[model samples]
Target: MIISTKLTAERLEEIKNHPTSYDENSPKLTKAQIARLRPAHEAYWNVTPVKKTISIKIDADILAALQSGGKGYQTKINSILRKAITTGDY
Candidate 1:
């Protein structure tokens, strides 16, 4: 759902040469501010990419390769599958 728009070369150059203005009145977030802000911010983060579990068959070598990565091997396995599907390597 992330749509990326590339800036034109001239526009990019203009932005590169532009001066930045900081608001002196704006306060930096303290540790307490961050602790209060994080939970609310993180709630809706990465709501996409939903995951489901299912049984599947695979070669022992492939399973070992996945499990050998230690913790989160299942996530690694998923990434491997995703890369294979995207790159037509499966």
Candidate 2:
């Protein structure tokens, strides 16, 4: 998640004049830890799979169960369907 703030002109000027200082005593990463780091795109695929909009009838109870989790219920259903498709284990 990303957060942004709108700073006033005075606040921006203050920041430019006196930048925040970092803690010198803070813990540093080890060589092994640094080596394990991967680019964000590598760790999380940047590709967005094409999506299709269609309607399929599902059991009322199952639909209720999926929606009980709240928002993103459609996404949850998509994930379940994708898993079933890949593993052939509906």
Candidate 3:
């Protein structure tokens, strides 16, 4: 599904306003409930160790393009690489 920029902004504002509507008596999970949920949350945090790293060369123009995109270029590259790996397209 395509997300329109205007709808995205509106949805974000709706989420931002949601907290203000909460009442003091809003239903909350008890300590026992949270204890039962902890295992699933912890499982998500259990990550496998990185086995290796490799240095690769890229064309100057491509490197410049990433750099020109500004801050978080390395993070953007990592995201792109992750997507490529997931899709087996690299």
In order of appearance, the predictions have TM-scores of 0.43, 0.46, 0.41
Q: What's the C-alpha lDDT at position 64 in model 1?
A: 95
| RMSD values, in order shown | 11.5, 17.4, 12.9
- Candidate 2 or 1, higher lDDT: 2
Q: List the residue pairs that clash in candidate 3.
A: none
Q: Write the per-residue lDDT of candidate 3 for residues 1-90, one digit (tens) a residue.
A: 965567577888876787544457865666566545545577776787474567889899988999999998877888898767645467
Candidate that would win on lDDT: 2
lDDT of 2: 0.78
Per-candidate Cα lDDT values, in order, are: 0.75, 0.78, 0.72
Write model 2 residue lDDT over 19-80, tens digit each, in one string: 54557675566656665756777747556889988989999999999999999999999999
Candidate 3 off by > 4 Å: 1-54
The Cα RMSD in angstroms, rounded to one decimal, for candidate 3 relative to the true structure is 12.9
After aligning candidate 2 to the native by TM-score, how far in Å is the CA of 64 from where it should be?
A: 0.3
What's the number of clashes in each of the models?
Answer: 0, 0, 0
What is candidate 3's local distance difference test score? 0.72
Query: Judged by TM-score relative to the true structure, which candidate is superior, 2 or 3?
Result: 2
> After best superposition, candidate 2 residue 49: deviation in angstroms?
1.5
